[model samples]
Target: MYRIGELAQRHGVNNDTLRFYEKHGLLQPSARQENGYRAYSDADDRRLAFILRAKSVGFSLSEIAELLSIEVDKANRVCSDVKELVDDKLVKVSQKIIELERFRQSLQILSDGCCGGPHSAEHCTILQALESFEENDPR
Candidate 1:
Protein backbone atom coordinates (compact mmCIF):
# COMPACT_ATOMS: atom_id res chain seq x y z
CA MET A 1 0.00 0.00 0.00
CA TYR A 2 1.17 3.51 -0.78
CA ARG A 3 0.18 6.87 0.65
CA ILE A 4 -1.48 9.46 -1.60
CA GLY A 5 1.67 11.60 -1.72
CA GLU A 6 3.84 8.62 -2.57
CA LEU A 7 1.55 7.50 -5.36
CA ALA A 8 1.32 11.03 -6.76
CA GLN A 9 5.11 11.44 -6.80
CA ARG A 10 5.66 8.00 -8.34
CA HIS A 11 3.14 8.80 -11.11
CA GLY A 12 4.45 12.38 -11.66
CA VAL A 13 1.07 13.81 -10.75
CA ASN A 14 -0.13 16.18 -8.05
CA ASN A 15 -2.46 15.24 -5.23
CA ASP A 16 -5.14 17.63 -6.52
CA THR A 17 -5.01 15.94 -9.93
CA LEU A 18 -5.58 12.57 -8.31
CA ARG A 19 -8.52 13.95 -6.38
CA PHE A 20 -9.94 15.49 -9.52
CA TYR A 21 -9.55 12.23 -11.42
CA GLU A 22 -11.32 10.37 -8.67
CA LYS A 23 -14.12 12.92 -8.70
CA HIS A 24 -14.45 12.61 -12.46
CA GLY A 25 -14.67 8.82 -12.22
CA LEU A 26 -11.47 8.41 -14.21
CA LEU A 27 -9.85 6.74 -11.20
CA GLN A 28 -11.16 3.83 -9.22
CA PRO A 29 -12.39 4.60 -5.72
CA SER A 30 -9.48 4.90 -3.34
CA ALA A 31 -9.13 2.78 -0.25
CA ARG A 32 -8.84 4.47 3.14
CA GLN A 33 -6.21 3.65 5.69
CA GLU A 34 -7.02 3.08 9.35
CA ASN A 35 -6.12 6.70 10.06
CA GLY A 36 -8.46 7.96 7.28
CA TYR A 37 -5.68 8.68 4.80
CA ARG A 38 -5.98 7.49 1.21
CA ALA A 39 -3.99 4.41 0.17
CA TYR A 40 -3.13 3.27 -3.33
CA SER A 41 -1.92 0.08 -4.93
CA ASP A 42 0.48 -0.45 -7.82
CA ALA A 43 -2.49 -0.80 -10.16
CA ASP A 44 -3.60 2.70 -9.23
CA ASP A 45 -0.19 4.07 -10.17
CA ARG A 46 -0.40 2.37 -13.57
CA ARG A 47 -3.88 3.71 -14.19
CA LEU A 48 -2.77 7.24 -13.32
CA ALA A 49 0.18 6.95 -15.67
CA PHE A 50 -2.21 5.99 -18.47
CA ILE A 51 -4.40 9.01 -17.70
CA LEU A 52 -1.44 11.38 -17.66
CA ARG A 53 -0.11 10.04 -20.96
CA ALA A 54 -3.54 10.35 -22.58
CA LYS A 55 -3.86 13.94 -21.33
CA SER A 56 -0.40 14.80 -22.68
CA VAL A 57 -1.68 13.72 -26.11
CA GLY A 58 -4.58 16.23 -25.91
CA PHE A 59 -7.33 13.93 -24.66
CA SER A 60 -9.82 15.79 -22.45
CA LEU A 61 -10.87 14.46 -19.11
CA SER A 62 -14.24 13.29 -20.43
CA GLU A 63 -12.64 11.65 -23.44
CA ILE A 64 -10.10 9.92 -21.22
CA ALA A 65 -12.95 8.63 -19.08
CA GLU A 66 -14.70 7.20 -22.12
CA LEU A 67 -11.47 5.65 -23.33
CA LEU A 68 -10.93 4.05 -19.95
CA SER A 69 -14.45 2.66 -19.98
CA ILE A 70 -13.87 0.86 -23.28
CA GLU A 71 -10.23 -0.04 -22.69
CA VAL A 72 -11.15 -3.41 -21.27
CA ASP A 73 -13.86 -4.23 -23.82
CA LYS A 74 -11.94 -3.22 -26.98
CA ALA A 75 -15.16 -1.96 -28.56
CA ASN A 76 -14.95 -0.98 -32.22
CA ARG A 77 -17.41 1.87 -31.77
CA VAL A 78 -15.28 3.45 -29.08
CA CYS A 79 -12.19 3.16 -31.25
CA SER A 80 -13.96 4.87 -34.14
CA ASP A 81 -15.26 7.62 -31.87
CA VAL A 82 -11.78 8.35 -30.55
CA LYS A 83 -10.43 8.44 -34.09
CA GLU A 84 -13.09 10.97 -35.09
CA LEU A 85 -12.24 13.15 -32.11
CA VAL A 86 -8.56 13.07 -33.02
CA ASP A 87 -9.39 14.00 -36.61
CA ASP A 88 -11.44 16.97 -35.46
CA LYS A 89 -8.67 18.14 -33.13
CA LEU A 90 -6.20 17.88 -36.00
CA VAL A 91 -8.37 20.14 -38.13
CA LYS A 92 -8.59 22.77 -35.39
CA VAL A 93 -4.85 22.59 -34.81
CA SER A 94 -4.17 23.10 -38.51
CA GLN A 95 -6.47 26.11 -38.62
CA LYS A 96 -4.74 27.63 -35.58
CA ILE A 97 -1.34 27.15 -37.20
CA ILE A 98 -2.50 28.97 -40.33
CA GLU A 99 -3.94 31.79 -38.25
CA LEU A 100 -0.67 32.13 -36.33
CA GLU A 101 1.32 32.28 -39.56
CA ARG A 102 -0.91 35.06 -40.85
CA PHE A 103 -0.48 36.95 -37.57
CA ARG A 104 3.30 36.58 -37.79
CA GLN A 105 3.32 37.97 -41.30
CA SER A 106 1.21 40.97 -40.26
CA LEU A 107 3.53 41.64 -37.29
CA GLN A 108 6.57 41.48 -39.56
CA ILE A 109 5.01 44.09 -41.85
CA LEU A 110 4.39 46.40 -38.86
CA SER A 111 7.90 45.86 -37.53
CA ASP A 112 9.45 46.63 -40.91
CA GLY A 113 7.47 49.87 -41.16
CA CYS A 114 8.62 51.13 -37.72
CA CYS A 115 11.83 53.22 -37.41
CA GLY A 116 14.01 52.28 -34.47
CA GLY A 117 15.42 55.85 -34.28
CA PRO A 118 14.33 57.97 -31.28
CA HIS A 119 10.93 59.54 -32.03
CA SER A 120 7.86 60.78 -30.16
CA ALA A 121 4.99 58.30 -29.83
CA GLU A 122 2.78 60.66 -31.90
CA HIS A 123 5.27 60.51 -34.81
CA CYS A 124 5.93 56.76 -34.61
CA THR A 125 5.37 55.08 -38.04
CA ILE A 126 3.53 52.17 -36.39
CA LEU A 127 1.17 54.59 -34.65
CA GLN A 128 0.74 56.52 -37.93
CA ALA A 129 -0.32 53.33 -39.72
CA LEU A 130 -2.85 52.55 -37.01
CA GLU A 131 -4.23 56.11 -37.19
CA SER A 132 -4.63 55.76 -40.96
CA PHE A 133 -6.79 52.65 -40.44
CA GLU A 134 -8.93 54.46 -37.87
CA GLU A 135 -9.55 57.31 -40.31
CA ASN A 136 -10.65 54.96 -43.12
CA ASP A 137 -13.04 52.91 -40.95
CA PRO A 138 -16.74 53.50 -41.77
CA ARG A 139 -17.71 52.50 -38.22
Candidate 2:
Protein backbone atom coordinates (compact mmCIF):
# COMPACT_ATOMS: atom_id res chain seq x y z
CA MET A 1 0.00 0.00 0.00
CA TYR A 2 1.03 3.62 -0.57
CA ARG A 3 0.22 6.88 1.18
CA ILE A 4 -1.66 9.62 -0.65
CA GLY A 5 1.50 11.71 -1.14
CA GLU A 6 3.44 8.72 -2.38
CA LEU A 7 0.72 7.87 -4.89
CA ALA A 8 0.45 11.48 -6.05
CA GLN A 9 4.20 11.78 -6.48
CA ARG A 10 4.39 8.46 -8.30
CA HIS A 11 1.67 9.64 -10.69
CA GLY A 12 3.27 13.14 -11.02
CA VAL A 13 0.08 14.87 -9.92
CA ASN A 14 -0.50 17.41 -7.16
CA ASN A 15 -1.88 16.37 -3.80
CA ASP A 16 -4.80 18.66 -4.57
CA THR A 17 -5.42 16.70 -7.76
CA LEU A 18 -5.77 13.50 -5.79
CA ARG A 19 -8.09 15.22 -3.35
CA PHE A 20 -10.08 16.71 -6.21
CA TYR A 21 -10.36 13.31 -7.84
CA GLU A 22 -11.68 11.95 -4.58
CA LYS A 23 -14.19 14.78 -4.35
CA HIS A 24 -15.27 14.15 -7.92
CA GLY A 25 -15.71 10.44 -7.18
CA LEU A 26 -13.03 9.47 -9.68
CA LEU A 27 -10.72 7.96 -7.05
CA GLN A 28 -11.04 6.27 -3.67
CA PRO A 29 -8.65 5.01 -1.05
CA SER A 30 -8.44 1.31 -0.45
CA ALA A 31 -8.07 1.82 3.28
CA ARG A 32 -6.99 4.23 6.01
CA GLN A 33 -4.14 3.83 8.43
CA GLU A 34 -4.44 4.32 12.21
CA ASN A 35 -3.01 7.83 11.80
CA GLY A 36 -5.93 8.74 9.43
CA TYR A 37 -3.85 8.69 6.29
CA ARG A 38 -5.30 7.28 3.08
CA ALA A 39 -3.73 4.12 1.74
CA TYR A 40 -3.84 3.01 -1.87
CA SER A 41 -3.64 -0.51 -3.16
CA ASP A 42 -2.47 -1.76 -6.56
CA ALA A 43 -6.10 -1.65 -7.76
CA ASP A 44 -6.28 2.04 -6.84
CA ASP A 45 -3.11 2.64 -8.85
CA ARG A 46 -4.68 0.91 -11.85
CA ARG A 47 -7.87 2.96 -11.48
CA LEU A 48 -5.85 6.17 -11.30
CA ALA A 49 -4.04 5.18 -14.46
CA PHE A 50 -7.37 4.65 -16.21
CA ILE A 51 -8.64 8.06 -15.05
CA LEU A 52 -5.47 9.81 -16.24
CA ARG A 53 -5.53 8.04 -19.58
CA ALA A 54 -9.16 9.06 -20.17
CA LYS A 55 -8.36 12.69 -19.25
CA SER A 56 -5.29 12.71 -21.52
CA VAL A 57 -7.63 11.84 -24.36
CA GLY A 58 -9.78 14.94 -23.62
CA PHE A 59 -12.50 13.25 -21.57
CA SER A 60 -14.23 15.53 -19.06
CA LEU A 61 -14.77 14.46 -15.45
CA SER A 62 -18.37 13.55 -16.12
CA GLU A 63 -17.40 11.65 -19.24
CA ILE A 64 -14.68 9.83 -17.35
CA ALA A 65 -17.23 8.88 -14.72
CA GLU A 66 -19.45 7.40 -17.38
CA LEU A 67 -16.53 5.50 -18.86
CA LEU A 68 -15.59 4.19 -15.44
CA SER A 69 -19.11 3.01 -14.81
CA ILE A 70 -19.17 1.29 -18.16
CA GLU A 71 -15.88 -0.37 -17.41
CA VAL A 72 -16.94 -1.59 -14.01
CA ASP A 73 -20.21 -2.92 -15.42
CA LYS A 74 -18.75 -4.60 -18.45
CA ALA A 75 -21.37 -7.37 -18.29
CA ASN A 76 -24.04 -4.80 -19.26
CA ARG A 77 -22.05 -2.41 -21.51
CA VAL A 78 -20.56 -3.06 -24.92
CA CYS A 79 -17.73 -1.60 -26.99
CA SER A 80 -20.23 0.17 -29.28
CA ASP A 81 -21.38 2.34 -26.39
CA VAL A 82 -17.80 3.51 -25.79
CA LYS A 83 -17.32 4.12 -29.51
CA GLU A 84 -20.45 6.29 -29.59
CA LEU A 85 -19.11 8.50 -26.82
CA VAL A 86 -15.80 8.91 -28.67
CA ASP A 87 -17.66 9.71 -31.89
CA ASP A 88 -19.61 12.49 -30.17
CA LYS A 89 -16.43 13.96 -28.73
CA LEU A 90 -14.75 13.80 -32.14
CA VAL A 91 -17.61 15.74 -33.76
CA LYS A 92 -17.41 18.45 -31.12
CA VAL A 93 -13.64 18.70 -31.51
CA SER A 94 -13.90 18.91 -35.28
CA GLN A 95 -16.47 21.70 -35.06
CA LYS A 96 -14.23 23.61 -32.65
CA ILE A 97 -11.31 23.23 -35.07
CA ILE A 98 -13.42 24.66 -37.87
CA GLU A 99 -14.45 27.64 -35.74
CA LEU A 100 -10.84 28.26 -34.71
CA GLU A 101 -9.69 28.16 -38.35
CA ARG A 102 -12.38 30.64 -39.32
CA PHE A 103 -11.31 32.92 -36.49
CA ARG A 104 -7.69 32.64 -37.63
CA GLN A 105 -8.67 33.56 -41.20
CA SER A 106 -10.53 36.63 -39.95
CA LEU A 107 -7.50 37.69 -37.89
CA GLN A 108 -5.26 37.16 -40.91
CA ILE A 109 -7.51 39.40 -43.02
CA LEU A 110 -7.36 42.12 -40.39
CA SER A 111 -3.57 41.81 -40.14
CA ASP A 112 -3.13 41.85 -43.91
CA GLY A 113 -5.26 44.97 -44.23
CA CYS A 114 -3.15 46.87 -41.70
CA CYS A 115 -0.11 48.99 -42.69
CA GLY A 116 1.80 47.64 -39.65
CA GLY A 117 3.76 50.90 -39.42
CA PRO A 118 4.73 52.84 -36.30
CA HIS A 119 1.63 55.00 -36.27
CA SER A 120 -1.03 56.01 -33.76
CA ALA A 121 -4.26 54.01 -33.32
CA GLU A 122 -6.41 56.87 -34.67
CA HIS A 123 -6.66 55.17 -38.09
CA CYS A 124 -5.72 51.53 -37.50
CA THR A 125 -7.28 49.17 -40.06
CA ILE A 126 -7.35 46.27 -37.59
CA LEU A 127 -9.23 48.35 -35.03
CA GLN A 128 -11.53 49.79 -37.73
CA ALA A 129 -12.40 46.33 -39.07
CA LEU A 130 -13.09 45.04 -35.54
CA GLU A 131 -15.36 48.00 -34.82
CA SER A 132 -17.18 47.49 -38.12
CA PHE A 133 -17.68 43.80 -37.44
CA GLU A 134 -18.97 44.53 -33.96
CA GLU A 135 -21.38 47.13 -35.28
CA ASN A 136 -22.71 44.94 -38.11
CA ASP A 137 -22.76 41.55 -36.36
CA PRO A 138 -26.27 40.25 -35.78
CA ARG A 139 -25.20 38.18 -32.83
Q: Pick the candidate with the highest lDDT.
A: 2
**Residue pairs in candidate 1 whose N, alpha carbon or C atoms collide under 3 angstroms:** none
Identify the leading candidate in terms of TM-score. 2
lDDT for model 2 comes to 0.94
Worst 10 residues of 1 by lDDT: 70-79
TM-score, every prediction? 0.72, 0.92
Instruction: Please state the error at residue 27 of candidate 1 in Å.
Output: 2.6
Candidate 1, 1-139: lDDT as tens digits: 7888898888777889888998898886358988988888787877888899989987889878877767756754656766777787778878989999998998898899888788678788888888898999999
Tell me the spans in candidate 1 whose CA falls farther than 4 Å from its real position. Answer: 75-78, 125-139
Write candidate 2's Cα lDDT for 1-120 as tens digits: 999999999899988898999999999999999999999999998999999999998999999999999989999999999999999999998999999999999889999999999999
**Count: clashes, candidate 1:** 0
